[model samples]
Target: MKTKTVYCLSGLLLGLLTACQPSDSNLKNQNVALQLQQKALNSTLGYDLVESLTVEVGPRLPGTDKDIQAVNWAVNKLQSLGFDKVYREPVQVPVWHRGQAHAAVTSPYTQSLVITALGGSVATPEEGITADIVRFNSLADLKQAAPESVEGKIVFIDHKTERHQDGHGYGKTAPGRSQGAAAAAQKGAVAIVIRSIGTDSDRLAHTGMMRYQEGIKPIPAAAMSNPDADLINNMLKRSDKVTLQLFLSPESQGTATSYNVIAEVTGSSKPEEIVLIGAHLDSWDEGTGAIDDGAGVGIVTAAAKLIQDLPQKPARTIRVVLYAAEEIGLVGGKAYAKAHQHELHNHYIAAESDFGAGRIYQLDWNVNEAAVNALQQLTVEMADIGVMPGNNEASGGPDVSMLPALGVPVASLRQDGRDYFDWHHTPNDTLDKIDPAALAQNVAAYAQFAWLMAQSEIILRPVAEKQSQ
Candidate 1:
């Protein structure tokens, strides 16, 4: 939760902020946006949608059968909710099978460990590799170490992810999980292991994407649970040397096609201009991706459903994109940028609800600074739900991060991600982690954001273009 957006709204509370409200012309829609927010706060639609998806579809890792099943579920759900249009766009995604993972300290003291293979990591030998452990405090240390210090050893990076309400710690500690293997492989290490990139003290090891260099040897990469890493650290302090045995069976199956499931509530007068909202449909196999993006799927879909119920349609289309393979590499999002290259100018704005089902506390965007003022009334309307205006510096969310650079301006309704990484990418990311009240708050913020933006006279462009002027 390091992003600080959660705690940065000190002076921007409704009346304390000045000269940021939209023009009087936009006052009519403010009432409508307020109504949408109230309706969403009382609705159980977000909780219900997530429950049905996680219970019925379970873990829908991309390229798996369940991924396709989730796609169908999304289409059916959207249509039943009476969206004007529902569709799927094909996206080719890399497929990696998580076979099995095992780790243990063989020397100093013998102890079995909980581990999970990093997504896209190569497999270890059939007999596995047992070697002396070479510990590094961070990936930078591993990169600085002499090859002689790491060769034939299991490189362990002990960088711990810090907890925050803003979820900024993940970015700081992620290099160890995403790039540690390649760094270790480059140095001739036989394998790489890192402290799980999560804040929980629980034994569930977090798993995420890791890449191999083109010409370098691909070594097995995995993450040990935080407690296991702590145990190993303690063992190192007492013993002359600690040896570890590692086994991982994950393998790549090349590429497979997945779909970005899409649904739209068409605008009454100006359907061509679109306000895009999204969440990923895929999740890691370790747990039901209930918090990672399943809640996001629920949030966006329910938000749009609320918008569609208005007596009069908004002026611009509201599009919901349930992205595919976000955990892999933002494959679906990249594909969308490519697929809709020509229509990008028509994208009024884009946003993604991928953090979790946390209460939203701030609204930020990567658009013209003037656009910020135009949406100020929106922030005021959302203030009762504890939301305030943030600066013009948001990438929206992971999947929609690509859109801002492609001429589709992006916004973020910042959720309280303080505990997001506690269960992120782990088996602990289950349905029980969600607070229905908080999830309802998210729905309210998103519904308000989407409806207000759709009906506003403001159409945002990339921030860079305006900033340069």
Candidate 2:
């Protein structure tokens, strides 16, 4: 009887041990995953890598020699970083050059005014166009003016932006800068000059792309420096008979083929799902594209390098796309959308850092309720770093605008844009403008968020699709 009892007890003990064994193994695996993630998140070398790239390969305007050099630098750097696969996918980009740009008040009183031509603007004759200036407070005002008031005259659009992080003033005031030339041309104006659509009160003008209306001839477009704009504005108050001269020589050559350098640290498990981080590789020719996008490229590259060195990879692939010709337009981004349209659905989350290098203070995500809980938890993890949640109705940066339409979720680490427009698209966008400590903070925040998202089982639902449904 005693032997039989011993046998029954031994059988029960073995069964219990078997049941507990699998649970212990799962716990160990989970712990290992946590450690690996922590290791990646706490990387120091990764931060230095990004800093080095930004400092060494300053501006990379598409189609320019600098742009090509920047691409080569990215390729070599990624290879050196030991990415499993680093490749350059060819991207056809527009080639626009900013030649000599000069603007001055030739009449009413002679004065030298600072200015820069808008991207894709046609140049004036060698002697330049001298015309009577027609000033308007807004585009609507310009439209309201009589044809004779603007005909054969340089239309001056004077507007000012109130400083804000969301760049509300820019949105309102930028129309004159973008469409002013075409708008004035329709009314028979010889050329157009607008108050620089930037916040700085200094003598530095901002340059951006200008799109001409279909069938409308492109004309000379220029932005006066803020201080110059002020001088023009004060002079206007004193007299409406301000005459101006504009001289610009912007040429558009044949298209050039560049590449959006992309590399990935593939997932150990679910490789199909992608968490993407990117920035435009192209910059305006005025200065090194440091603040505009060099910082972004650096930020994304560093973030990914940190993840790559971890003992275990995240479940979803992390892709770094250094886009080309973002400064010209979304040319590179549009091309990317077209090339990857078939796989757009696979992009789980996409974030872009295009705004100037400012301390990131808020984070907004445009995902559905399914991932809201996860993001909320993530926000709690990032609160110590001054990152807070924003509205779910986010569409990402201008470069990745098409992705949201294709069901890719988008988010933003809303950097303080208070001082961004000051140096944005200007010659002041140099490496000295970047604050290292602030950049590192940005890196830490991005690293933590990206790792958490990649590790989490939840996926961010596409905002457009979610809204439609």
RMSD of each: 5.3, 8.6
List per-prediction Cα lDDT, in the order shown: 0.87, 0.76
lDDT of 2 at 266: 94
Clashing pairs in 1: 1-164, 1-165, 1-166, 1-167, 2-167, 2-168, 164-418, 165-418
Residues forming the 10-long window of minimal summed lDDT in candidate 2:
1-10
**Candidate closest to the true structure, highest TM-score:** 1
Candidate 1 structure quality by residue, lDDT tens digits, 255-326: 888999999999988899899999999999999999988999999999999999999898999999999999
Candidate 1 residue 236 C-alpha distance from true site, Å = 0.4
**Candidate 1: segments with Cα more than 4 A from true spot:** 1-25, 465-469
**What's the residue-level lDDT of 144 in candidate 1?**
95
Q: Would you estimate the TM-scores of all the predictions?
A: 0.94, 0.89
Candidate 1, residue 337: how far the Cα is off, in Å = 0.9
